[model samples]
Target: MTVPIEDVRAAAELVALGLRTGARPTDANPYGRLLERYRSQTLFRDTVDTVASGLGLVVLGAPARTGLVLSTQPGSVFAVRMGDLRSTGMSADEKLIAGLVVLGVAAYAFPQEADLDSSEVKTVEVAALDKFVRDSIERVLAVPGDPESVDGQARTAAELYRRTAAFRPKDRQPGPAKGCTQFAVAEVLGWLVERGAARQMPQLGASTFQLTDRFRLLVADVAGGEALEAMKAVRAGQH
Candidate 1:
C-alpha cells in the first residue's frame, strides 16, 4: 500500500501540536482538521501512532471533545521526573513531601471511582489540601502496629510536614517559602497548572485549582496504585 506523503506530513504536524500545546479536535483550523483526519483515516491515525512511538510517546487516546492525549514512555524525553517538580535548594525530604503533595491533590480531587468517571470539574484549595494530607498522615500513624510497617515515603513526608509550619510568617517576604505547608501545596498546584494537569480558579480564590481532563487521564492510568489506594482509604474512612 502506498502511503500518501500528505498523510505523513499531517501525522507529524498533529503529533507536534500534541507535544507543543495539546492538540484538540475542537480547536480552530488545522488542529481540528488534522485531528478529524486522525479519527476518520486509519492510515493517518496509524502514521500518527508510528511517529509518536518513534519519539517514545504513547497516544493515550483522542476523544473528540478533549482532543489528543499523550503520555511518555519510560525514559522518554518528555517524561517528567519527581526531581523535575522539586524547587531549587530543596532537601531530599522536601522533595519527598512534594511528591506527597501531588498525591494528596490527586486523592482530594477524585476520592471516589464515581468522581473519576464523572465530567464534573473537581476543585481543590491549598489550605484544605494541606489539612487533608496532614490528617491522612495522622490517621495512618494512629494505626496500631510498628510505625515501620507504614510506607516509608509516607512516613518521611509526614514527619517533615509535622515539623514544618502550616503557613509562612506574617512578617516574611511574599513568595513560596520552604518548610511551609501552604507554600508547598501552592507550589505543587502551580506546577500542575503549568503542566496542563490543572488550572487556577482566580474567581474562586488565588490558591484554588480545578483539575483538567488531562490529569484525570493520567490518574486513571495509575488508579490502582498503592499510594492512591492508601489515600482513597483515608478518604473513605472519613465518610
Candidate 2:
C-alpha cells in the first residue's frame, strides 16, 4: 500500500509539536489542527504513533484538550535522567532529596486518585511543598521498622532530608542549596516548568505553580510506584 506523503508530513509535524517543551495544543495554530486530525483520523493517528515510536518515544496520550503527550524511552536521546535534574556540584544526598522533591510535588498536587483523573487544574506552593515533603519524611521515619530493609533505606533518606533546613537566609544566593529544602524544591519546580510538566503562576505567588496535562500523564503512568504510594498515603493523612 502506498502511504500518502502528506499524511507522513502531518504526522511528523504533530510529533515535532509534541517534542517542543511547554507546547500545548491550545498554545498556537497548527497544534490545534494537527491534534484534531490525530483524534478524528485513524490513519493519521497511526502514522503519528508510528513516527513517535520510530524515534523511541512513547505516545502517552492525546486527549482532545491536552493534545499529544510524549515520553522518551530509557535510552532515547530525549530521555531525561536524574543527573539532568541536578545542578553543578550537587552531592549524592542532595540529588536523592531532589528526586524525593519531585515525588512530593506530584503527590501534593494530586493527593487522591480522583484528582489525577479529573480535569481540574491543581496548584502547589514551593514553601508548602517543601514543608509537606519534610513532614512526610519525618512521619515515615517515625514508624518503627527494621533498619536493614526497604523501609530502612527510606528512613535513611528521611534522615537526610530532616537534616536539611527548610529555608536559607534572605541574603543567600538564588539557587538550590545543599542544606535548604525550599531552594531545592524551587529548583526542581523550575525544571518541571521548563519540561512542560508545570507552569509558574506569578499572580498566585512568586513560587506558586500549576500542574500541566503533560505532568498528569507522566505521573499517572508511574502512580503505582511504592514511593508515590507512600507519599500519597502521607498526603491523605494530612487532610
Candidate 3:
C-alpha cells in the first residue's frame, strides 16, 4: 500500500525545520535531538532519484514525464518516470495520486529545475497529507497487520531526507528570505549528519556540506547504488 503524500511533505518540513532551528520533540521538553543528526556532522548522500527508486518506483529527472504511484499502505507512494515499466494491477487513481506526490516533491527538491512551487501540489487540498498518512496507517493496522506497511512510513520519512539532502554549498548559505530555505536545508543536512548518512565539507566553505562513505553506505543499504549513481551522474552529465 502507498502512503499519503502529505505525510512525506510534512516529514520533510519537520526535518528541515528541525535542522534549521533545532527540534523540540515534545511540547513539555524544550529541545529534542530528534534531528541533531542533520547538523554539520552528518550527511545524506542519496539523491531524490535514489530515494524514488528505493521505494520500488521508476525515477526520471524529467518532471514533464514523472508521476506519483499511490499504494494502500501508508507511506507507499512512488515517484515513477514517464517511460518506465508499469507495476502490475496499478489503478488509475493510484497512478494519479502518485504522480501528484512525485511532482510535488520534485518541485521542492529541484526548485530551480522545476517551474512549480510547494503551493502547486494538489494531493491534499481539502485534507493535509500528513494527517492522512497517520490516519491511513491507523486504519490499515486495524484491519490487517503488515509490518512492511509501517516501515514504509519510515522509508517515506527517509525519502524526505533524500530529496532535500543535497550538498549544495551555494544554496546552503543564509540568504534573505521571509520563510528561510537555506536554513531549512542546513537543518535537514544536520539530521542526515546525525544518522551517519552525511558529513560536512569544510573545504566547500563554512556554508557548504558533502557526503561521506557512511552516507553512501546508507543509500546503498536502502535503495541500492544505482539511484545514487544516477544523482551523481547528473553533475557529470551537466554541460
Candidate 4:
C-alpha cells in the first residue's frame, strides 16, 4: 500500500490542531477530512496511531465516524493537563462546580454491577448542582464555629468556605454580572464543551448537558475509585 507524503503531513496536522485547540474540527474541515482518510486507510491507521501515541494522545474516533474525540494520553500522568487548565478561565467557585459535575456524571456513567460495555453517562441539571452547592453551604453554616481566630486575622480558604456555606449560592459571590452559582455552572460546562467532552442540549439551554463518550472515557478513571463509589452510595441512599 503506497502512502503519499501529503497524506501523512495532513494527518499529523489534524492531530496537532486538536491538541492545540482542545476541540475537534467539523467534519467538512480539511483537517477532519484527512483525519478520516488516514484512520480508514488500513495502511495509514498504524502510522497515524503511532504518531498519536508518540505525542501522548490517542485517536478516539472510528474510521467511519464524523465526529472525532482526540483524547488526552491515558493514565494518571495525563490526568490534569496544565495546558487545558490554563485555557479555562474558571474562578474558585466555578472550579468546585467543575469537580462536582464530573462526580455527578460519573455516578451514572460507571454503575456498579452493570453489564454494559461502554459507560452510561448521566446528564446534570444546573439547578441540581446549584442546590447541591447551596445545601453544602447551608450545612456548614449550621455547624458551630470555633471562636478562636489567629490574631483576629483574615479567614483562611477553609474558613471562608465554611462561612459562605450558609449563604444562598447566588448570594455567595457578589459583583459578578451573573449570579455566582449560575456563572460557575455555565463556565464549567462551557469548559467541557470546548474540550469536546460535553455538550449542552440546545433546548435545555444552560440547564443541562449530555456527557459525551469522550468524557466517560477520559474522565472516568480520574473520577473513578472511591469518588464514583461515594456518588453511587449517595444515589442508593447508602451513604
C-alpha lDDT of candidate 3 relative to the true structure: 0.31
Which one wins by TM-score: 2 or 4? Answer: 2
lDDT of 3 at 145: 26
Ranking by TM-score: 2, 1, 4, 3
Q: Which stretches of candidate 3 lie over 4 Å from their true place?
A: 1-180, 224-233
Error at 104, model 4, angstroms? 2.7
RMSD of each: 3.4, 3.1, 20.7, 7.9
Per-residue CA lDDT of model 2 for 77-147, tens digit only, reads 88886678755757777767777788888888887888878889889998899888987886666655576
Candidate 4 lDDT by residue in tens digits, 56-106:
777766422324445656662344632354364545544444454454445
Worst 10 residues of 3 by lDDT: 61-70
Model 3, clash count?
33
Which residue pairs overlap in candidate 4's backbone?
137-165
- Candidate 1: misplaced stretches above 4 Å? 21-27, 64-66, 86-89, 139-151, 170-176
lDDT of 2 at 74: 72
- Name the candidate, 2 or 4, with the larger lDDT value: 2
Between candidates 3 and 4, which one is better according to TM-score?
4
Local distance difference test, candidate 2: 0.81
lDDT of each: 0.77, 0.81, 0.31, 0.52
Task: Summing lDDT over every window of 10 consecutive residues in candidate 2, give the lowest-scoring window.
Answer: 169-178
| Best model number under TM-score | 2
What count of clashes does model 4 give? 1
